[model samples]
Target: MGLGSYLIYIALLMIVPLWAQSKVKNTYKKYAKKATSSFMTGAQVARQILDDNGLYHVKIEETRGMLSDHYDPRKKVVRLSRDNYHGHSMAASAIAAHEVGHAIQDEQAYAFLRFRHSLFPIASLGDKMSIFLIIAGFILGASGLIMAGIVFMGFAVLFQLVTLPVEFDASNRAMAQLVSSGVIRNNEERDTKKVLNAAALTYVAAAMVAVAELIRFVLMFVASDD
Candidate 1:
């Protein structure tokens, strides 16, 4: 019964995240093919947004790898993937704008963003250590080790929950900037929103997965106690 329950739980957790990832990729590809009417390349859009926001010191650079765009708050650089940096599609523009949104958050010192940044190192270590601790605890019948594992995993879960708002807020900022800057009209903004929303769902799926994992482990610890 335990084994069967575990299998079911694993299956349930996997489904939503896999589907969400596929949705994000498909939505992005669909919009990537449709060029924006504004004729503004993503790099141009990012630069304009930064300049308008008085973030002239932030740099935009093209990086290799699909869907690898991100804002490096430490370096104050907005990194865009190859296609997003040069392509004029709604997808490209929206993705670039979203990263710039992070830069905006940095400039404003958004609380959640700052918290997420501070948690990065601890979360990274916790993620790697949790599996080993859980496995060891289960094998050795050590409740204390198991509890430690749960606490470590809890940090990761907290990071994920915190990430939800940061991501959603970034997307919101992206949409507003896209509209207000004339980078995209209302109809085009709809397409951009679709892309951003699809991307946001991936983060939601991730948080769900993290929460499920934490719950699963806590249940395991309880069962072991019994």
Candidate 2:
């Protein structure tokens, strides 16, 4: 790709995530206002699901920040944002269930989630070191260093790719749990799906950006060789 094309690609990398973030936020905001028919809080829903799945040891804690919910596999804890933890809304129920889905995955040793976890250390190191190594390689005119950097970048890209399946499976589990547990009524399932799907888009956008950047880096490296 030419310089102009590269510029456009970079712009897209920036735009796609922003757009996905906006979509999730807007969708969450819309559904957050609409209470579930069950009138159950996010924490309550999560607790019920965890207990039903025999995850009594896994704990749910209230966390600060907007949409900061996550399951810490190391700690065996599901942390929910304050809004979701306390709010009795469709968004809350959906998000809470999604995080608990991860906990269930942990208990079951879900393959993709296990693979992703195993890759996390290398991916974290790659994320931290790749840019600096690549820049240093260019400065020193060292193709070896550049290739090493690209390899590290490749790991990060793989991590993102693996993450896609892990997230989608979690969302699928979340919806099933929601239905089975009666946390969300049949009529409310559609909007709950909207919330989970919007959240899933953010992961899709992240993986796309990572793959695109890796391709751009490889192209730059090959051009330098020429």
Candidate 3:
């Protein structure tokens, strides 16, 4: 397909997830406040989970953007968004704990997470190289350039596949950690699950779409060669 058509397709693929994300974020904001009676700030809950899980080495830091919470495996840090960092709501607590889950995974050397980390460097390289390869390949219409583009896209897809289990396991950890730590009561587990599941859906959807796009690109190049 032409670049114009590709752009349109990408735009369309992006819109549904964006809309879904917005709706889920709103839903979490509405109900997450009512999750548990802990009344602990996000940072405090993060501390509790770290201490409880014996992950004293993992640091909690504030990051820019709303809902940008994540665990950076390279740095062994849990970066929480400003809102999630300091907010005194169930939403904040749950998110903080979720990041802590990654720390625990790192400590335990969880198989999937370790696999994801192993792919990081190549994935980073692939992320940067993919666009350049694709743009250059289109300009030259060279088979070698097209193949390079395909390889780069394949690396990215591999990263996404590895990331799937890491993220889902972290969400699972978050819920279990809360109960084990007494940060959240058993009765309120469902609320925590809802918010985390909603967040997880975004990642799962993105990975699926990435795979689809990569397959499309490969097929296009192959057909052109034929």
Candidate 4:
């Protein structure tokens, strides 16, 4: 609860992001080189899945990040990152299919993804509010402000929890569709699984960092009060 304890927590917090980033980058690179099945570009694969599911309105567009692909429920579009957008590898097919899984979720009104997307605005606001509330609480020496900060951070934690099911479902759908539709052969299943699993770990890593930071903030308030 003292300065040394807080410093250690902060240092640990810093490590997850770097480690997660490195793992994702390495996984993508490793699969990119080893991929042998080259049936379609990532974009083509995504579009194929979308059309196959009759989601004609859900457009697949390029976004500007390495492995930053995602589905925008609001825009009803799939955004593919640079590597998978044009890359023709098992990794690309998997990435593209994963985003499409989200689109499928939208069509079927999957509970978890819907909940997560619905919480986006509240979670975004709470994330900023938590910081301000915590700092103001510390400066004013008020337990009430710290309590409010905790509440605000609670939404951030909840968002992370809500994301797990959504992410896992997408990966499941991606792998299933790939296997069933003959997009990825049985021999290539492991490659896709490797990419998706590595990507999922990054989400888990982010959630852990948020939870750790929240604990550190709570410790600060408890220490100050003592």
Candidate 5:
């Protein structure tokens, strides 16, 4: 019965996400070799966008690792991976601009970003220990502990859901800025879209996995009660 009920969730949690991850990687690699017409490096594009938006206080810095780019709201810093920071490829420009979009979101007080930010500590703890708690609870046959695990995992699921819009909006902002600012030409817009869209699918897959996991737990809890 468990296998029958969870078949779809299992498929979604496994196949789709792996595919999305591969697609993003492949897409980024395909465009990473194509330099932008303007020949502006990722760091330059990011700086221009930030300055244009009056985000002079937001600093752009380099970070190690592929696709490690992110905006640290607490530090007011936009950290880009080495390739994105220094490379003048289409992939680099789009990604660097995307991180700046988050900075813009912070400056404008975007509600979803702010809410997700506020949940960081709780969600961090939940992500770390929820699995252990769930396993221990199941082993001990304790419904109370199981429910406690469910609540903890619930925060993680909520965070993933909230993150979807934040990511999409940031990508949208990135594309618009890239085009309007003349960082990317009209012909280059499609490539940027492909990269951003491929990246967005990863977040979608993540949200689906979180929802599926939460549903599986709820269903199991119900079956146990029955």
Candidate 6:
């Protein structure tokens, strides 16, 4: 049963992300061609929302990448991909607003976002080291190293867990801002939400995969003991 469960989790780890990415890509592709009623570029929407939220210091910068939009809390800047920064489509508006939502969270000192930020350094290190440590532990039959690896992996899993609420809240803030700032109309709200929801699923999928990996590691540790 344990082996079967582990294999199932392994399958999920492989399948979930691919499914999530497909949803995001499909949803984005569908909406990217659908122009917003306001016809405002993503930069314009981001600028308007930021200014309205009294985040005047938050700068909007264009970046090169697909789906690389993010808010740099340290730099106090909202970076949008070239497509989002210049495009005037539902996908552009939704993505821009979602990133600006992170800016708003930063300004408000959102608890989850702050917590996630705090966890980033350790989580990053753990993410990089945990797999190697686990593999080495298994190879050398060192239970202590296996336990240490599990602890490190735990931090990464915790980070992923905390990231969920932060992402969901950002999307919520994005929708509210989009509506309140008149960036998207009532008729367009559904489609905008579809875009954001699809994006959120990617995060959810990632968190699930992280959790499953942690469980798999724990199971491995137990099996090693026997």
Best by TM-score: 2
Question: Where does candidate 4 stray beyond 4 Å?
Answer: 2-8, 36-38
Number of the top lDDT candidate: 2
Cα lDDT tens digits, model 1, 88-117, are: 999999999999999999999999999998
Instruction: Report the poorest 10 consecutive residues by lDDT, candidate 1.
Output: 1-10
Off by over 4 Å in 1: 1-8
lDDT of 5 at 177: 93
Please, what are the lDDT tens digits per residue for candidate 2 over residues 1-226?
9889888788769999999999999999999999999999999999999999999999999999999999999999999999999999999999999999999999999999999999999999998899889989999999988999999988998999999999999999999999999998889999999999999999999998998888888998999999
lDDT of each: 0.92, 0.95, 0.82, 0.86, 0.93, 0.93
Select the stronger candidate by TM-score from 2 and 5: 2
Q: What does candidate 4's lDDT look like per residue over 1-226, in tens digits? A: 6789778777668887788878888988888766536477889888888888899999889999777788998899999998788888888888899999999999999999779978888888889899899889888987899889988898988899889889999999999988876788878998889999988888888888888888878777777878
Cα RMSD to the true fold for all candidates: 1.4, 0.9, 2.9, 1.9, 1.2, 1.1
Give model 3's TM-score versus the native structure: 0.88
lDDT score of residue 190 within candidate 5 = 92
Provide the lowest-lDDT 10-residue window in model 4: 31-40
* Candidate 3 segments whose C-alpha is farther than 4 A from its true place: 1-12
Kindly list the per-residue Cα lDDT of model 3 for residues 1-226, writing each as its tens digit. Answer: 7799788667757875796688678867876557367777788899889988788888889999988888887898899999778887677877898899889989999998888878888888888888688778878887788788779878888998888788888888888888887878877787777788777777777787778778787878878878
lDDT by residue for model 6 (80-193), tens: 999999999999999999999999999999999999999999999999999999999999998888888889999999999998999999999999999998888999999999
Candidate 2, residue 201: Cα displacement in angstroms equals 1.1
Instruction: Tell me the deviation in Å of residue 70 in model 4.
Output: 1.4
